[model samples]
Target: MNTHPAPATRETGGAIAPHLRRLLEFVEPDRDDVCLDVARGRGPMPAALGPQVRHLTAVDAMPAHAPGGHGASGTNGRMSTVEFGTGPVRIADGDTPPAAATREERRPHPLGPDRTLVKADASALPYRDNAFSLVTARFSLYNLGDPEHVLRELLRVCRPGGRVVIADLVRGNLTGPDRDRIERLRDPDHPGTPSIARLTEMITSAGGSIRRLDVFTVERPVEPWLAGSCDDATADRVRRALIDEVDGGPRTGAKPRIIGGELWFTQSWAHVAAEPIP
Candidate 1:
């Protein structure tokens, strides 16, 4: 078991392959097994992880997580929309995925019948115990109110000897008050990023044995990141803070820098896989 955390690193182009590959490497899904992706929310997971498994269950807290669904969240200047339906599934942001969805819609869907969308609480999964072989969640911890509880639930639904993986932005060692304030301003639902050490503990406490832990960074232009995510006032505050950090006022460990005349910042993330005690 690897207990020591990896150092922060950086990547560009917003490509999804590297991260998705790392998760697959750790989980190593099989075609005959069922996998659950919690808090999927129209993320890159469905397209990337779906093809490799026998069945993929994608769940989100709200209908808005799907394309054309009710409610919307800012993403690359577009919103996720999904047509919803009535079912036993009920989800809430910070809790989990959706319950009902249209299967035959010709609209640009990344998943097929092999995939299912459910609205349910992450902390209170509606599935039977040991129902899945692999379970995962991506980029959702910062918004979760009780990540530990959710992890335990994920483990609970995972079959014995199965694995659970979580990937999210890790608070840099240099992260401090200024950076936290900016993050909250940009996304009010942001509870705050967690350190790699803290995350390891969360999984282990959930009865998972650590198998792998990898760290890397993703770089993005600052302006676009804050564009639709925040109001003018809050965006201004974030910009000022970034400028100060670039000028050496204080480091947020976000690595704010000017590249090709555009302001950019890097966020570190940790990808972890842990197996349940069989």
Candidate 2:
């Protein structure tokens, strides 16, 4: 069974991702809104939902394809149970798998009439101020350093009254940082995952007013999650760490457990929706 990952679409594994579906609903995209998705890690979002809007552009600092002659495609995806975690909405709404090819980035720019992929930095976007109605930075924020600077950039490009959605795997104090340590063990490129409150605070500090906040708990298998994120040896280490935690060693914060004899863990993600503080 292939474990490496490819960017997931709405139709990736023959079914719609429930979390993604809920996210789109929170975005509340309009037919005329121009959108920007930054650092599309695990999902080819613009490619999948491009036609749904006027135009959607995705930017990533890294190249479209992974380095060192890797092939495209992964094990599709694993079924997950997405449960709403927390946060109260004022009135409005709203992870990577591996290093794999996405249909948007590899091909020439403008994947379709309404979509384009560019290699750009989140901190220094190559766009005019207030150029988009909606800007999003998914699982990519933690991978890039300086959350405040990036959040400000995202808001700068988003026109006032427009919204910016930030989402990522958030770490909790009670859970500890062990899970994130394992994440770094798999891929050292990630700087850090911030707590849920920290992310929202950054948005406000970046000149954005919080409109809504939603958190979700995603339950998925541990093996598949590690498959493409790291090599076999590193994966083994991660397994040992999680297993040790399961064996009453310490809290991993990953909440690892056995489900039908398969190792599984739950990841908590936060989705913050905010508009410019105009």
Q: 93-154, model 1: which lDDT tens digit per residue?
A: 11111111111122344668789887676667789988998888886544333778778887
Model 2 ranges with Cα > 4 A deviation: 1-14, 40-42, 62-110, 173-175
lDDT of each: 0.62, 0.65
lDDT of each residue in 164-187, candidate 2, tens digit only = 887777765455555678778766
Q: Output the lDDT of residue 88, model 1.
A: 15
Q: Name the best candidate (by TM-score).
A: 2
Error of 1 at 1 (Å): 30
Residue 9, model 2: Cα distance from true site in angstroms: 11
Give candidate 1 misplaced runs (Cα > 4 Å): 1-17, 62-109, 172-178
Residue pairs whose backbone atoms clash in candidate 2: none
Clash totals in order: 20, 0
- My TM-score estimates for the predictions, one after another, are 0.72, 0.76
